[model samples]
Target: MIWDNNFAVSIFPILLQGLWVTVQITLLGTLLAAVLGLVFAVLRRLAIPVLSQVVSFLVVFVRGTPLLVQAYVAFFVLPAYGVSFNALTTGIVVIGVNYSAYMAEVYRSGIQGVPKGQWEAATALSLPGVRTWGRIILPQAIRTVVPMLGNYLIQMFKDSAVLSAITVVELMATAQAIGSSSFRYIEPLTLAALLFLAVSYPASRLVNRLERRYAPQH
Candidate 1:
């Protein structure tokens, strides 16, 4: 029950290791989400009838479904179909895929928020589609959406703990395991909370600062 003996001696190391796993998953998953979401956003914006419809359906399905269910399906169901991934990989894929749907929407909104005049200006300049988007639209859209993307990153970080359900040994899972084994919940659970607070608080502040810095001036 003592704080010094239990927390500092036994629980800190285990929680620290778990935090590392959580950070790894969050970073990898966020990268995947960013890449895939941007692809989906661009595809949808292109308005290619069949391809657009297919991407729309995918985004809707992923966004409509629960992430935990996705995790379970990835880990438990995929093996029956001759596709199997390790728990950690499955967790990353599930989290990344789930968030990509939402991030796609975020990206689409950001892209669309660019004034129609910009697109027209690019067209009048005889810029190719790729060049126009790359040079004119994407830069502004990305700057506008950076804060939202950062918020998603923080959310992803917290949600990575859910990977423990599949035995991924992330932060929450490590705390649960250590607490159960040692029959001491206070120290491990407290350590996990502190770790989350330590990262999330600063990340949230950074997101706010980004939003302020990028806000369009009057």
Candidate 2:
């Protein structure tokens, strides 16, 4: 009764469009995180002089800071320095960079878990360094970490709500806009919750299934 039927109906389409933007940000951000994370993981394993140390410091800094602050810095503060980006791009970069640090740790553990014997075998066979990693080490490490990476993807999806703070007009932002304009919080906020649950729940189940399927076979 607080919102007229017409207003509620009209807002649904707007929210759905906003949801599409959220999905796009999550997908692109996850892709970037996955690639950057793997690169960092491999670099950490290589322990290449100062580059490894710098990357290690960066990973710690990103993982330590709050993501909302990062979003604000990327969207608001960067613009003052003549580094302007649209809301969606800012959201993607912030989330991707933040999660990449966490994913890098997950990947590092996976790579380290590979038996030393495997590396020794590659060396004994006179395999080139790149071929050894690409053919032997990376495949096993990736299988171990895929589930964790998928979980990070889900986490990024949920965290996309934070982008609302930067005026990204994602699902939560759209909900807030509709609620503020119409003075009805229940329907729009409730709908956003349901939409997030609908996506996240299934994605989580898929992650579990992947973990079970790809788990180390002893």
Cα misplacement distance, residue 70 of candidate 1 (Å): 0.4
Cα lDDT of model 1 by residue, 37-148, tens digit: 9999999999998999999999999999888888999998999999998899999999999899999999999898899999999989999999998999888888777888
Task: Go through the candidates in order and give the C-alpha RMSD of each one to the true structure.
Answer: 1.6, 1.6
Per-residue C-alpha lDDT of model 2 across residues 1-218, encoded as one tens digit per residue: 65466766767888888889889989999999999999998898899999999999999999999999999889879999999988888889999999999989998988888999999999999999999999999999888988888898889889999999999989999999988987888889888898899899999999999999989764
Candidate no. 1 TM-score: 0.94
Model 1 spans > 4 angstroms off = 1-4
Q: How many clashing residue pairs, candidate 2?
A: 0
Estimate candidate 2's alpha-carbon lDDT, on a 0 to 1 scale. 0.90
RMSD to native, candidate 2:
1.6
- TM-score against native, each model: 0.94, 0.94
